[model samples]
Every structure is written in C-alpha cells, then in structure tokens.
Target: MIRSSRLLNILLVSVLLPLAGLSQAAGWPRQVVTDNGTITLKSAPKRIVSTSVTLTGSLLAIDAPVIASGAGVPNSRFTDSQGFFSQWGAVAKQKHVQRLYIGEANAEMVAAQAPDLIVVSATGHDSALRLVNQLSSIAPVIVVNYDDKSWQQVVTLLGQATGHEDQAQTIIYQFDQRVTALKPALKLPPQPVSAFVWNGGGKEVNLWTADSAQGKLLQQLGFTLAPTPTQLATSHSMGQRKDIIQLSGEKMSEGLSGKSWLMFVADEDTVNQVNSDRFLQQTPAVKQGHVYPLGNDNFRLDYYSATHTLAILEKRFVH
Candidate 1:
C-alpha cells in the first residue's frame, strides 16, 4: 500500500510541475515604466486604440490589430497626392482592422470602446495630456514621442508594451540591414540646394524649409537646404509677422533654382497646372527630370512610412 501511494504522488508532482512552469513562461509582466508614464497592462492587451500617426504606423508594422484609430482621414483623400496612407490602408486591412475612425475623439468616446490599451503621442499639448488622463481612467495609456528618439527605440518601446519585443527588435535589425545594403548602390549627385513646394491653389504655394519633416528626410537623403531669410529675420525683429511668402509658378521655380527641386502637389489640378506652366517647365530639374513629385501622403515619418519610402526608392532609383 505504501509503495503504491508513493508512486502515485511522484507521478502527480512530475505532471503538475511542468504545467506550472509553462504558465509562468507564457504570462508576461503586468506593468512596465515607459518614457511617457507607468503602464499597467492587464493580461497582454488584445484590443488597442492608437491616436497618433506614428503609433498607428508602428502598430501596423508589427502586424498588430488596432480596434480604433484617431486619425480618421481616408487614405483615398491623400493617396493620389502622397500614397503614404493608402499603402498603410492595405496593410491595415491585412491585419483585419474593422473599426476605421474615431471621429471627434473625447474621453467619453474612448471610455465607451472598452479598449485594453490606448496609445498616444505626447505633443506637449494640453489637449493631449487631457486625453491621456481620460484614457487612463478606462485602461492603461502608453505615450510615445517619435520626435525625441530614434525610430528603433520607438519600435522597441511599442513592442515591449505589446508583448512583441522580440519581433520589434528583429524588424529594426532588418531595416538597418536594408539601409546598409542600399547605401553602397546609391549614386548620389553633389549636394544640391533643395526646396519643397506645395501648390495650395489660388496662387498660394506653401514652401517648407529645413524645419519640416520632409526637409529632415531630404537632408538624410543628402540634400542641402535653402536659407529661410524671412524665418531668420522674424526671430530677431519685434512684432514682425512670422509668415514667409508663398511662391508659385515662375516665382516657385526661381525660389528653388540652382539645385534639384522636389514638389508635393496636393490636388490633381495643381499637378496639371505645374506641368503646363512654361516657367516651371523651363526649370533645370524639369528639363533633366530631376524634379521628384512627392505623392500627397509621403510626408509621414514613421516606421512604416520610412520602410515604404526605402522600398519605393530602391525599386525606382536603385537597381
């Protein structure tokens, strides 16, 4: 009787011990301190709501499903002009994102969704803080600031929060490898002064200097930026209007002369207008086909956006 009891006890302990170990391995920690704040994740968030463009892009990059998105702008509205959001839409569909937009987001709207986690970008705005606090009342809020850190760090932070740290790191590594391989193949010309012109119609063209995201991306691509004298003067002058003149047509061509020009036309009409303008047609870049027409949506500088741009450049420019 004693020997039979001993054998039964040994078998029960052997079977139960491994099951307990497995459970511990599968359960991730419930909370972590992020750059934004303390995040308390309850049972690996299954439903996520993303409010910022960067956060939404990151989530899609990792094949994570977003139950709700705050940026409700349709991809079609900007795709023809820029193509960034449209590419993201296809990826989002693949991830099964059923809920599209969170129109006029407020605490009430977020609370009603019952999300497992709410991800937002800290923009140093009072409204942003209010939204984060409101969302925290419903569930954990993880804030990420892409402007303050490297893209790899942003991805890793999101991965850690979502229980996919390993996947995020791998993606970052692969992105670095792609960049390294492409650098050698690039036959870049001498650094030329560049300007980004957006034809907003009615003879008003919006010109962006080195302060913009597109400008930063251009610099990364080895382009020199034009001097913004008005912007510089306004900083020193008292009660001076901080606005720069919007140049179009001949003025636009002249403002961007002496170097390759990149123009972002928002509407199809604007594109046709620029193509038909004799002054624009006579520019150096126009004659040489060096003028790159940026799609209306290509300005987003998130993880997916960067990756997509790399792929597009590789296909179009690199062999």
Candidate 2:
C-alpha cells in the first residue's frame, strides 16, 4: 500500500489541477471570429506581429503590443523611411516596433519575430494571406477585412481581439466627439461630390465608392456621394473590390461626372495640376471649378489620419 503521506499528496495535486485550469479560463482562452475563421488564444498575447502595414495603425491605436510590422514603400509622401505611415511612424518608433519587411510579405522575416500572434489583412497590397499556413505554425493568426468596414469598426474588432476594448472605446469616443463638434461648424461644399485618387495623368483613376472608409467619413460629415454611373460601376479594370473602382480611358471622364470633385491622396500641387490639365477642361468638376484636394494624408483613414482629415476639412469648409 502507498505511504499515508504520499496518498495525501496525490489527493492534494488532483484537487489543485482543476482550480488551475479554471483560473486560466477566467482571463484567457479567448476566441475571436475573423475572416479566416475562429481563432482561439490560450492566453493573452505578449508579442504581436502585423503583416499588413495598413492594419498596423489600428493595432497601435489600441496600444496592442506590436513587436514588428510589414511596411510599405519607403520615403513616400504617405510613408516614412521605415515604410510606416507618416501619421503613426513616430508612435511606432517610440514603441520600438521593428519593420518586418517592405514590399512583400516574407515568412522567414515574420518567423524571426517569434510573435505570439500574427495579423493579416484579407485584401490589400500588404496582405500576407498566401503565407497563412506557414505563419499558423509559428503563432495564432487572424485575418481582418478592412475594405468593407470603417476605421472605427476595424479598431473595435482589433480591440476585442487584442483585449484592449476599453482603449478602443476611448479612441472612438474621442474621434466621434471631434466629428460631432465640427459637423455643425462647417458649410458643406457642393452636394454629391465625387472622391477619388486621381491617377495624375488623367489616364486612370481609383474612385472611392460608398463602401470605402473615405467615402463613409465624407458622408458622416454631411456630404452626399454622387452615385457612380451604373455602367462604369459594373465594369472596371480592378477586380471586384468594395473599396475602389479603377477606371481609365472614356470611363475616367464618365465616371467622374459629379457636381464637385474631392481628390484624395492629393495636395494643393495636385489641385494646380488638375486645374491646368487640358484634357480635363471639359469635365463637369473642372468646368465648374469645384475640384478640391483632400490632402495626401487622406489616402488612409486610420485614427490619426482620419483625425487629420477632419482638421483639413474643417479649415477648408467651416464658415
């Protein structure tokens, strides 16, 4: 027979095991539903890696522990030398978040980070969905769809995933408050404005539709978006995407047939170029002299850029 002390020790060990599991379940074993499917985290992640540069802003907004991030083209008007968006580049630097890679997603580079969690965008130039299986072996991965949702929605989803719901709420509330305070102070420009990233030469354009974050923000600020022509809307160069429609040739003029044009990813220089372009002289927006630049920073609508957009609009349109 077992010694009396040994028997008592075994009984004590069994009693504590269930309680330990219960304690773990209380704060952890969190589940988040993502585009890729449901992901279960055994515990709160300490190190997070973002494969989408665009998603990095939202992650940083909620104070997620992002150890590294995929980057975009370096030193562009929109991005810094490290390829982080200019809006949050300083914040990323302050947090010491390293750039995982630029241009393409590299599985080896990501693996080197040894992250507890990996984030990928469902669609965008920065997406790493092709390497999902490879990344899953390293850590739990979640795919977020940014095109269909507003920036606020993306932050809320990420907050839930990263266990920063309160931080997310605080940011959202602050942004909403600013938007609310500014809404009544401004006189909206021409109704039904067409917003797009002008392809510079007037040869092509990436038109922002109602579903895009930029479009939603404009609408929230009380500007009605002109409905895109049915024909141009159905047929486009870029494949079916909810965010932007790529148009060129005759479609460029026909698609931009709005009372006013608000060019995103543009600055005052872009406005000057559009004003002087001979080919676009007859366009309704040009003929009416209603073309306005929404600034280069308006290209992405993360929390920082979105707030900047509000300031730009308020200054331009406030009575």
Candidate 3:
C-alpha cells in the first residue's frame, strides 16, 4: 500500500508540473519573429522537418516531434554511431523520425516527409537561404540561427516556434534557479580557466571566449575567461567573428601555462594526445589535474548538449 501510494504521488507530480506550466503560456495562435520575418503558428505543429543537426536536437529536447532530420551523414551517430550525438540521435530513432538528407538540404525529400513546419538553421548547412525559399512555397519555414543566442534564449525561441512555450520557460526558470543555488558552492582557482579545442594539427588550438556557445556556459559558472578580454577585434577562420582565437606552439604555451583547461576534444585518445603534445607539455591544467573533457564526441554543443554540460559541472565541481 505504501509503495503504490508513493508511485502514484510521483506520477501525479510529474503530470501536474507540466499542466501548471502550460497554464502560464499564452493561448493558441501564437506568433514569433524569425529570421525570415514574423511567423504566426495557428496551432501546435504535428510534423516538423529539421534541416540542421542543432535544430533537430533542440526540437527533440522540448518534446517536439521532428518527423525528419538532416542527419544521414557518415559522421552522424544516426548512421551507426550508437549515440555519438547524445542529444538527438536516440530521440530521433525512438521517435522514428526519417533521415531526410545529409550534407545538402533537399526540398523534395523534406516535402515527402509530409511536414507541417520546416525548421532550417544557418549552422552546418551551406545553402540556408536557397533552402528557405524552396521550402516556403510548400510549407511555413522558420530560419533559426543558434550560434549567438544563449541556450536558454534558443530554447525559448524553439518552444515558441514549436508551441512548447510554457515548457521552454519552465526549463529556463529551473536552470536559473539551479545556477543561483549552485553559485555559492564553486571552488574556483586563482588563475582563470581556459577552454580550447585542438585542430589536430601539430600544436594549433582554438580558444573560446565568453561569447562562444560553450564559453557562455562557462561564464555562468563564475569562471573568468583564461586569456582575458572577452572579445578581440579581428575576422578570421570559418568567419567565426572575434570570439574564437587561435594559437600555435609557443604562443599557446605562453597563453595557458597558468590557467586550468577545459578541452572539448571528441574522445579520451585525443585528450591523451593533446596532453602529451610537446606544445601542451607546460599547460597548468595538464600538470595539476585540472584539465577536463566536455565529451569525446561533444565538440559542438546545442541546447541538449549545454544541459548535459551544466549537469556534469554541477556534479564534478560542487562539494
């Protein structure tokens, strides 16, 4: 009798929390501004076609039924990766979403999926503008660029666009609450923490600033940017703006010797390789056991990825 009562209470809370959240969202026929223009969604989308990996992952995180995804590539876990992309591949598979396309956006393929809403993002896709024009003729399209926005902001936009606004706001509220609670527990060191990714070149490393997607998360944790000065003036590789800076060999050695490190490399072998590299031999993080891996395959973080990142930080860094 006692165990059954406990289970029932747990289920009730789970069901009621979402109901309570939904009550706070505005009524149906919602409108959200998109890159294309003002988009008004008359009702919740039943079928959504996600044209980018980031959007696919974001949509799935909020319980949006993404009917198709652009994850048919060789590098994708959906191909055979067994959750190489932890955020979406399994969710996409569990939802039985179709693999619509890989490297290029296919309007016909996406159309055949019979989607009511098509989501395209400017990340990782070459022809966003052309695809938007093609899909607009068939159905409503929202062009989301997840690069510059905070994860909370991105999820809020996604929720509004997909009719999960209440849930989106709830996630942000809960996350901010958690952060507020966790702030008093961080045991930061004297020097700053620098996060980086190696290009697999001899000694080249790309450093992240406060504005970078991952760097934004780090900033919330009260860690100062290692190299200091959040943004610099310069346009360079991948046109990544000024937030990501590159260094090689002796230059990298000088910048990160005193700071702890966060490595966004894909796996343990690569982590070992980066630690052993001659250029990184003097890194303070490698010496003091402060070097940490975000995830082996989690090179680029999206909404779900950032959530996982925050959870891991809370567990590892807190007393």
Top candidate when judged by lDDT against the true structure: 2
- Output the better candidate (1/3) by TM-score: 3
Give the CA lDDT, 0 to 100, for residue 151 in model 1: 57
lDDT of 1 by residue, 273-300 (tens): 6656766777676667565555554444
Enumerate residue pairs that collide in model 3.
Answer: 266-296, 267-296
- Report the lDDT of model 1 for residue 32: 58
lDDT of every model, 2 decimals: 0.58, 0.84, 0.68
Writing each residue's lDDT as its tens digit, candidate 3 over 1-319 gives 9999999997886556544545433677877787778887788889998877656776777788788777534554223353225555677678887776666778889889888898887554433557787898877898876656667767777887887876776666666667777767877654578887777554577777667777887788787876543232242236754346676777676655447777774446666777788877666677776777666444556666676766666766777
Ranking by TM-score: 2, 3, 1
Error of 1 at 153 (Å): 3.6
Lowest lDDT block of 10, candidate 2 = 17-26
Candidate 1 CA-lDDT value: 0.58
Put down candidate 2 lDDT per residue, 215-263, tens digits, no spaces. 8998888888989888878754336468888877767777877788889
TM-score of each: 0.66, 0.89, 0.79
TM-score of 1: 0.66
